[model samples]
Target: MALPDRYTGDDFYCDVAIPSAAQLDVVHDDELVLAYHHTRPFWATHLVVVPKRHIDSFTSVTECDEADVRQLFAVVQRLAREVTEREGAAAVLTNLGRYQDSKHLHVHVHSGPQRDHT
Candidate 1:
């Protein structure tokens, strides 16, 4: 999956990805957030759960309201549980600072073997 140069360099989630999520394989969609399969998955069962609005990263979550944060986690929790049950195990994660590719508060719910990115 060849990503656009802008996707690698900028907040593609806020600028394009999230808005165009309809094209992705969505798992959950609500007023609070959107959960979908990763376009370029690093894990076999990778899914991304993100707040409907941007918040930069996990460390910058204070910018969002408590309810927004709660809702996002609630969704993440459910997805994690589902993945764990179906796949025998699951991992939930969020990156920060330089590790965060997308400048948006998002959680990843994934299971199974990790995939080779290169």
Candidate 2:
């Protein structure tokens, strides 16, 4: 789960217009993608990779989403390399449907032993 919803009940990605780009601690930003530090991190090292355009979840990804999805993964690949090189290992993951707290499609790049986030 993320912070108490500070905005209207909308999928985070779709509301990009609400958060000025300057407010986002963006790592990678382009026409199709955005990668940044997770606002709520579960692991010692965590980063979030998401598309600037809304894509719901992996289940909602379609052939039309191919280019954007590939762009998303490209960001993930670069960040994962940086994380693993720095920490010795890394984990890249994403959730779907009930498993995904936010409806927007995103990937988590993390490192370190798991801990009780709560």
Candidate 3:
């Protein structure tokens, strides 16, 4: 049988509480959101955009969550633009169910060809 896409149920993003400014390859950060390099990247250039406060997933969002939703998208927008300008291309991705390994809300901003990552 094939392995599952997301192995752990752990809230990987929330577990870190954000690494030190030095340890975190942070692309962008604010009170509501964070954009940082993937700890284990599958693309040549991969960044993870997350809400500082947990939101679960896109499907978990609610009317009360409007501000957080906007903030997360704003961060995604800035990072995608910055990466695309530098790399000439970018893609943004998110997943649900088994596709979302971490169980926390996040967006991926990436560019360049895929790479084998640990």
Candidate 4:
């Protein structure tokens, strides 16, 4: 899939990626959440799980985001389990503050050997 000339991660999930999820290798999709293979994978098996709605970041979650938060973690757990079962090991992770490249909340479910960085 062709990407923008500049791969800026800032809010890419909500602004760009989610809208084009159908074209991606989607793992899971529903009204509340979407999970798909990463466009630029860091591991042999790398998947991204995110809320369908716009939530700035985990730290920025508000009371109104309760349902979305629950759904997000539930999806992450399921995807992590699937990856672990298939690869014998898996990691579930989310970034924050400076670590978070994207402004939107997202979790990564990944396993297997690490790939070379681009």
Top of the candidates by TM-score: 4
Clashes of 4: 0
TM-score of every candidate: 0.89, 0.84, 0.86, 0.91
lDDT for model 2, please: 0.81
lDDT for model 4: 0.88
Of the two candidates 1 and 2, the one with more favorable lDDT, higher being better, is 1
lDDT of 2 by residue, 31-92 (tens): 99888777667888888888887888988999999999999998999999999999999999
> In model 2, what lDDT does residue 17 have?
29
- Which stretch of 10 consecutive residues in model 2 shows the poorest summed lDDT? 1-10
**Reference-based lDDT, residue 102, model 1:** 79
**Local lDDT at 57 for model 1:** 77
- Cα RMSD of predicted structure 3: 5.6
As a TM-score, model 4 comes out at 0.91
Model 4: worst 10 consecutive residues (lDDT sum): 1-10
Q: Indicate the residue-level lDDT of 52 in model 3.
A: 78
Write the residue-wise lDDT of candidate 4 on 10-82 in tens digits.
8888777788787789989988899999988999999999998999888899999999899989989888888
Predicted candidate 3 versus true structure: per-residue lDDT over 1-118, tens digit per residue: 2223454646777766344434677888888888889877889999999887888898999998888789999889988999999999999999999898888899999999999754
Q: Provide the overall lDDT of each model, using Cα atoms, as 2-decimal numbers.
A: 0.83, 0.81, 0.83, 0.88
Model 1, span 1-118: residue lDDT tens: 3345445556767666667877779998888788899988999999998888778877776744677788889999999999998999999999988898778888999998889977
